[model samples]
Target chain A: MKDLDGLDLPTFEDVIAAHARIAPHIRRTPVLVSEALNALTGAELFFKCENFQEAGAFKVRGACNAVFGLDDEQAKLGVATHSSGNHALSLSYAAGRRGIPCTVVMPRTAPQAKKDAVIGYGGRIVECEPSTSSREATFARVQEETGAEFVHPYNDPRVIAGQGTCSRELAEQVEGLDAVIAPIGGGGMISGCCLTLSTIAPHIKIYAAEPEQADDAYRSFKAGHIIADDAPDTIADGLKVPLKDRTWHFVSNHVTDILTCSEQEIIDAMKLTFKRLRVVMEPSCAPPLAAILKNPEVFRGKRVGVIITGGNVDLDRLPWIKG
Target chain B: MKDLDGLDLPTFEDVIAAHARIAPHIRRTPVLVSEALNALTGAELFFKCENFQEAGAFKVRGACNAVFGLDDEQAKLGVATHSSGNHALSLSYAAGRRGIPCTVVMPRTAPQAKKDAVIGYGGRIVECEPSTSSREATFARVQEETGAEFVHPYNDPRVIAGQGTCSRELAEQVEGLDAVIAPIGGGGMISGCCLTLSTIAPHIKIYAAEPEQADDAYRSFKAGHIIADDAPDTIADGLKVPLKDRTWHFVSNHVTDILTCSEQEIIDAMKLTFKRLRVVMEPSCAPPLAAILKNPEVFRGKRVGVIITGGNVDLDRLPWIKG
Candidate 1:
């Protein structure tokens, strides 16, 4: 909880501080439980529904932390990020809360609903090619032009500390959770979970759920090094990013294991969650449930926490309703 | 809050009894609030989400009350009901919990999903031709053969009192609501709201929302008499039946107004609820929201309670997705 290299990397103390700083700007989303889902999966599941969060995702936690933690002069200059999904909307929402300009670079192929949400939250979108190089190039140009503070989606200490607040709330909301599972995208949420659970409830296991199609996190953990993917295609669009050093520190140390699920499994689990929990969430959020369903032995007969990461999908183009 | 007409007709006292009797069987569903929704409509709204209730609707409260309220001799023969929706599912669920026999008579034209749910909950289903005369004849024969106690979907005092528990919880959860809106079908929920709110908080306006395509409740409220509709088609399939004597007693005496919304407005409101609330409520539950959106002048800047009725929907057959 002490100085972790002058806060360049967040410690448990930093996450606790993030909770205090971002508490006013973000929502204290409720934890939901479903008997039908518990019966179906054979696990006592507690869902931390970040889909009900301000920007419709857990990304808001970190974004709010980063935006609000900035010095007044730095915050006035604004914030910039590159995200094709919930992070863009969340950063925009956080920036809007502080009454500052937000610049977001998103892939042109990103869903129109996500783009609309970012714009609705008062973000200026800088469209980039779907490739990572184009996105970074555009992001760099925007940051330079706006002179905005650069806040990486998952690599920054403030954002990781911010996401840590979710698990802190979950640990307090549900007693005796045997394990906690969160879908790993750029490893922000899982790292945050590791950051908090390691410091507080060290006995609890942390699992990172990933899409099989975009399984860089799984591969990286197995290989014992960072394995970057350029453009991994999956129904879970939010999880295509590779892990960086800040996120890797926690994933490599605190996480018990990284689990993976197939594209069909993700879609089916998502449909089931929608049916039983009656909560509308995107495909990216479904991997944790899919992992539990696929490996019931891992989660059976235990109190487990499942984080529903986001709920910003175009209803007109649900994966199951094939055109 | 005393007894009226012996123990046969439910008084406000019956609602209090129902709340205690059914407490062991039903869920004390959560009250949700969405800032985005409030910002859009300018109404400080509190949603009593019965969509998350056991058997996926508030009918479970009534069904549980009816099943549990029966005496030793009456419960021996078990219960019977004729419903094409949530009531049938609810009765079966309650019966399943008590380990008793339950018989449900349904029109052959009812959705396969509803029939499956009834059977899944251990109820015997007898399908009849999709006509009022045929349904009545079939239901009579089933009850005669099975010797089951008839629990009418919305007409019976037991069911009305059971539904009253919802507003009771809402009153305890959120304070000083200017109005409460519920979608009306056979006037059961609205009547329950009337029964509870009139006694507990007489200053709060009670509004009944009805689909314009099946506006019998709206017409009957204006005419100051019960106007029975045998069959009326609407997307809110649950709100098609006519008001009966027990429900009419409360609806006529206590309800402030009956509001109607067009089919298109209902669908649009449903989509909005799915997007903003992140809960998968059926079309029948969308009328309160639709009415609020259409009549913001009446609800603007006021604290309003919106009851979300049910979540038993077929995802494959979403209205926005054309075949």
Candidate 2:
């Protein structure tokens, strides 16, 4: 299997540059220290609350960086992408800020709240069946018809660099972090974390927390090969993506471990978040929390950082709690 | 009705002193800025997220201050209070930290979650009927039986000084705020807000937001007399307190305006808070937001500071959205 050596890995300097560019456009989301969570796991926990970021997700950092970094001509041509939810809303918001057009190819089964958010931000939506093949086909058709530049949610170099800015800020926000854990979907967030952490704090361990049902990244990392889910099913809608070649390379090279957590554990952690932290997080955003709770032996006594990547949960579809 | 004269009025210096003393015990809750809210209301809004504070509300600040400020004899007897919800949990949490026994007189109608939280924190409960007469009589009986020092929820000087810590932090967090707004319940929050603003930024205007259905403070401000609700009815369970003499005096002297918002407006603002800000705010916490939304012209083009006071909403009884 080919490694990430030939890929254009974002340098720490590049992430720093991206941070500066997006600083004016995005929020420096708060880093919260949870005493209750720390007491529960016996570890000092630093929660990077990207759930409070603009558009209610860290995807805004990447989306804003990608849209704002474009050349005048490319930006004028506008951008399009396919996403489950967070990335689409983020792209729409960023594009709206720049007065540029944004079109999103979303799954027909995507939450109505998310669909409304996309349209609310002036993004044209192209709905397709809930399958990778259909999403790719739909995105291709829309891109070809509209002559819009493709902004692959996690595959593009610019998007990866853009995502790396989150880790750059995290590394600066807290000190003495023994490890940083983030949920892996298509590996965009983990890849960005790896690139930034390796360059600045190379000794810090980087782990990926994946849902047990969608453990392709975990299997791929362990077997020294890229793996795809045969038929994925998880309540963590944001983490449904199968890894791409570029992201897989980065994960293969830099991520220290990939941890898997159960759906019940995810729900339990989401409830803890709502009860203690007062932030509503989707299932995917709870994986790192589940990992820390279930396997405290690994994270205990260490300064651990967890990224609460998004809080765009549909109130009507909240999996664990009933209204 | 006598006003808070120069001798009795709390100065910014007093709040600063109280803040310094209580800083170690209280959570320095973060200030979150919402671009989505800003665009919606055309005002730059700064949210002081006391919902994320320890004990799940700003009440802890006052509770801790009141509990810990007691002299050795007073501390030995422990403390007691009557509350609908947040204050009971806060007082319990504070008393627990001091290794002292605490009792809470609560209406039988208080939410189960709040009752559980009070017990979970080790506070003994003395349940009474929903009316003020019954609550006061029950509290008197409990106080006489146990010899526990009664800590009034809002009327006490120490509690008011403790609540002032929130605005002191806010004054430091956001510069040049044209005005500050907080939900008025027992008038503790607004009284403390007035004290802090009058002391630190005398030029900054202060507004009290109240539910129209339970507009005791609004009526009092308008009629130049204390107005107790003849039939208090609102979904904002936390803000149903009739004005106490001390709080009413402070508010009349320092508060610039007391505005009333309809129950529907409060419910709608709560929904927006859950959807956009991802914070689960109870209806009382939504009053300031309701004020901002209902009278956008008053706040438009201004830097407005809003205190999101608590997040003790029972998901099962969420009033705004139909299940």
Q: Pairs clashing in candidate 2?
A: none
Cα-based lDDT at residue B47, candidate 1:
96
Among all windows of ten consecutive residues in candidate 2 chain A, which has the lowest summed lDDT?
A1-10
Model 1 has fnat of 0.71
Q: DockQ scores for all the models shown?
A: 0.78, 0.52
User: Candidate 2, TM-score vs. the true structure?
Assistant: 0.93
Runs off by more than 4 Å, candidate 2: A1-6, A107-112, A127-134, A145-147, B1-9, B107-112, B127-134, B145-147, B321-323
Tens digit of per-residue lDDT, candidate 2, span B1-323: 11355435455566777787778788998888877799999999999999988888999998988888788788988899998678899999999889899999988887787898898778999899988799889989998988888878888777888999998889898999999999998889888988778867899899989999999999999998898877789988788888888888778888889888999999889888887788767788998988999899999999989999997777655674466
Please, what are the lDDT tens digits per residue for candidate 1 over residues B1-323?
33456535677898999999999888888888888899989999999999999999999999999999889888989999988899999999999998899999999888888898899899999999988799999999998998999999988888889999999999999999999999998888888899889989999999989999999988998999989876789999999889887788888888888889999999999989988989999999999999999998989999999999999988997877775
Lowest summed-lDDT stretch of 10 residues in model 2 chain B?
A: B1-10
What is candidate 2's lDDT per residue for A216-307, written digit by digit as tens?
A: 99998988998897778998978978898778878998998999999998888887877677887778899998998989899989998889
Displacement of the residue B73 alpha carbon in candidate 1, Å: 2.5
Error of 1 at B42 (Å): 1.6
